[model samples]
Target: MATTSPSERLLKTICGSCLILAPAVLLVGGLLHPEETTNAARQFEIIVANLGRWELAHWLIAASMLLMIGAVVGLAHLLHEHRPTEGIIGGATTMVGVMALFAIASAEAAIVPQIGRSGDAQLFASIVTSGGFWVLLGPVLLLPLGLIIMSYGMYRSRVAQTWVAGTVALGSAAFAVSLPTGSPVAFAIGLVLMFVGLARVGWSVLAETDEQWHHPPQMGAQLAG
Candidate 1:
């Protein structure tokens, strides 16, 4: 058992919570989402008219992305322990991507909802529904890019099992791929993969922490020495 700092334990907890809960909230929002097709104005009307309908999903999705940044950073800390001299560039890129993801999520959620508040039906209908290019492209590129970087760093760090690192990286890529495909089911799978991979890393760290708590390294070292 090895020692873990308080920051490490907290990071593991936050990352684990985000990994476990983000997807669940997103899934619920997806389920609660309106299933019918309507004109942009009509859709905007519904969204504005009933914030309750999709607000949870909106917040959850944004929050999840925000937390992902933490997850990346926390995982990086562990991976750094193994490969001190390698993977700095990848980690920095991933951090930038995560920041971009948060910004995108925040901007989109804020803007789209404003249409509702404005009560301009024509404007809502007339306005763009694409959520802007940056928002659209942010997750498609940034999120996966971060995860892949984290995965690479983890692999290089030798902190994670080969399969764990590989699966997580693959899952991140798969999720990113599904984003552009415009398929809800496929998107869900990607989210699942993101959650799965993150959960693996977070959980591993927590487990290690618990082991260290129960069996401190000093005790083992004393025995060995």
Candidate 2:
């Protein structure tokens, strides 16, 4: 049997963990989120009332984005052999979207809390109305788009179960739409589905032997020959 390198083993562990943990963390964050309202002042009041939970939730969400970056790259690597084009494009696009969402979550966790602490509803409202906020938010749409593309690649490559790919695509779309539409029910459903899909992938990764994880079967065969 071919030996697995230490680095490969570590990489596999990290990616597998991220795939499982990212969605789970995001779910916790979503569940912890306080009530939101259309009114800026009312939203600020809600934040103030549940300050600790609010900050923790956004911070968790930001962390999940960072974790998801690793998960997406791992997925791309898995798909590269069978569907290189989709793997690369989907990974890059998803990375950009995840990073943008990370910024938004960070701002909410760090800056919004400060604004609420200052009791500046008008300032918060002004910031929201300003074009810059929406500009920052727009890239988030890329997340669902990338997920759908990636899921299609997974389906075509037969790397994952068809149901898994379908669930991820549907969940990502629902999650993205829920954000702008303020549909908490959809958000929760999306996260649950995503968790189910990703956890299966993660489990598969974790089940791989170090040698199997390090080299694709074809590559291993080539090396053996």
Candidate 3:
């Protein structure tokens, strides 16, 4: 087995955390979906009404936040270790991606319970249509942009698969454009992209590290002697 470095371990840990949190938050969002009406105000009401559940979601989001912080710190270490521009850029891009997610999650956490309790989908939709949900747009819409940039950095550094990075870029773009059309298929595709990209990055890290362990060079071995 290849010996692992502290820095790599740290990166893996952070990335693993991110991997775990992404799905967890998504799962929570799904659980709350039935409660979320089209109405933004009602969403707020639901959040308020279901304080305990909402609070639990909020606490669960800490995992995501911790992952982001760890990624940022790990990126710094990667930069220091290699002085590579790609590392710096990738790290910063990841920071932005996580930050956007955190913001989105935070906003949703606030308003979900409210709307959930309002029990009026039409009213919620009206509020969202009236720009009440505009705040949600930034985090939802802009996240893919950050992800694309991060993917680009990963592609350039060869830290991740090229196809995965490309998918993230394309998927983000699709989601951004599809928001206005409200196309479920397109939106689903976009979600798939983001989730797949994240998963790929995490899996790649583990695979790369494992490969290193199993393929270490032989000591005092002659080169084609």
Candidate 4:
């Protein structure tokens, strides 16, 4: 096994840590989100009353999403090295899906929560029913889709063990299936599977110098020059 270069090691570490942390942050945010009551106004009031915590959760969620984007991009680079063609497809899918999810979350973080804080029942009611709410659900499935695709790519590329690949693909699919039903626990668990799968591949790359990553001129300059 070839020892991983310093630059490669840094990216793997980032990928391992961030992908692992992303789901945790998401679960915590879900737990922090206000539960709906029978009264619409009452719900808004509750969120407003706990506005500080609500905003904090959104901020954390936003941060986690940003971290995910970084991790995914890093992982893509690794995958491209493992299997140039298929790895690109897998990594690209994951990157796009995760990016979409992140974009939606970031948008909500910027505006949707502010509506709750404003204490406007009419505005809240109107906004919540608007396309904005549905848009949130739109990106939810993309994440799992990407994960499943990436897992398949990993398996095909011989990037990880069969069991690890199966776990990632199954878990990701389950996560997608569970989302519409509003299951945060399942999503979090699915993320754990992906983290483990990525870890297996990442560690292999880190420990084995069999795979070498060639950075472009600009990137090489940034990392080594």
Candidate 5:
């Protein structure tokens, strides 16, 4: 019996983290919409414990951010060196960027004071809607874009159940549409679907790890007889 190497362990850890984060990213981000019910933000604030259990929620959100950051780093690494089909790298990188933005927004929402404050709501809304918020559109748009790319990549790689890849694209599109409509429930459902799609991707990747490993060759050339 042989022991696992550090790189292998790290890869597994990263993949595991991504599997866990796929849904969470969607969940926390789903709650950041200002257009949703006023209670939406309030609910998130309370979820983050800014209202009821301050210390507990604060730690929870902080931990969530840390985990997301780690997952993003792992995602970046997984995409950085891999020679996937055209646009797959770009698309996955875009997803990483989106996750980064989502993490930032989550952090902002988590730490802000939840108590009564005049004019703060208006200011927050402006911030969330302006370029700063609109910049979020990059990630928002890229999620589906990346999913489409990943789906295509899987198809090109001749992987089974290619149809599953399409779910990410569909889910992202649904989530995007739900946003402007001011329907948090729809957004949550969309994210749930997106997570399912991601889970499929994760499962496929993990299950096929041995079949997919692509480590570089050692620096030596040998002539064939």
Candidate 6:
């Protein structure tokens, strides 16, 4: 049996915790998010009305993104022996997507409040319509794309159950759709499904024995033969 080093144990614990918590934080943020309308002026009004909640929610979302990045890395580490290519590519892509989301959340949490308080809906609308904004937002699509890729890899590797991987992919699609349409209900549902899938993964991670958790990738491959 492979001995578990302290560092390995610590990393494993952190990964499991992140998988369990990230989705919960995102779900809370989504639920707290105010509904939006097509009218920039009305959107501004809603923001101003729920300024504190809005800021808090976006901040939570940003935090969740950071945690998600860590979770992705952990998952990639686990998948390395089984599907190295997918693990590396999917983890990198997901990290990029999560970083883009963090940027958007930061703007909404820190910058949007100021804009809302100024009551200048025109400015907000203009910013939203700008090329720069779209450029920054474009990478958000990678989140769902990377998730699908990673989930498919997990399925192929038999690391994750079919239903679990499917749920993650489905949730990613729904969440991606919600982003463009600004649908809070859809966001909430997506988060719930994501939570279910990730929580199962987290549980599996936690259930690993010390020897299994610390097994070297090369050793894992040899044992599989």
- Give the best candidate by TM-score: 2
Whole-model lDDT values for every prediction: 0.59, 0.81, 0.54, 0.62, 0.50, 0.80
- Superior by TM-score: candidate 2 or candidate 4: 2
TM-score of each: 0.71, 0.91, 0.58, 0.72, 0.61, 0.90
Q: For candidate 1, lDDT tens digit of each residue in 92-178?
A: 666666566556556546765676777776766555564664354664476577667767766665566666667768876776775
Superposed by TM-score, candidate 3 places the C-alpha of residue 24 at a distance from the truth, in angstroms, of: 6.9
Q: Which lDDT tens digits does candidate 2 get at residues 86-204?
A: 88999888888898889999999999889888888899889877877668667887877787788888788776777878888888888888878889989999899888887777777
Stretches off by above 4 angstroms in model 4 are 1-9, 36-46, 199-225
On residues 102-197, what C-alpha lDDT tens digit does candidate 4 reach at each position?
676666567656887666778876766676656666666776777677666656655556676688788778678666665666756765665565
Off by more than 4 A, model 6: 215-225
**Tens-digit lDDT string for candidate 6 (1-225):** 777878888888889788888888888888888887767677888998999999999999999998897679767866787888888899888888999999999989999999988888889888766666568757987887788778877777777677878888888888888877877777777889988888777777776777656642322222231
lDDT by residue (tens digit), candidate 5, 99-133: 65556545554544442133255455554456664
lDDT rank order: 2, 6, 4, 1, 3, 5
Residue 48, candidate 3: Cα error in Å is 12
In candidate 2, the residue pairs with backbone N, CA or C atoms under 3 Å apart (3 or more residues apart, or in different chains) clash, namely none
Which candidate has the top score in lDDT?
2
Between the candidate structures 2 and 3, which one is better when assessed by lDDT? 2
Model 4, position 136: C-alpha lDDT score: 66
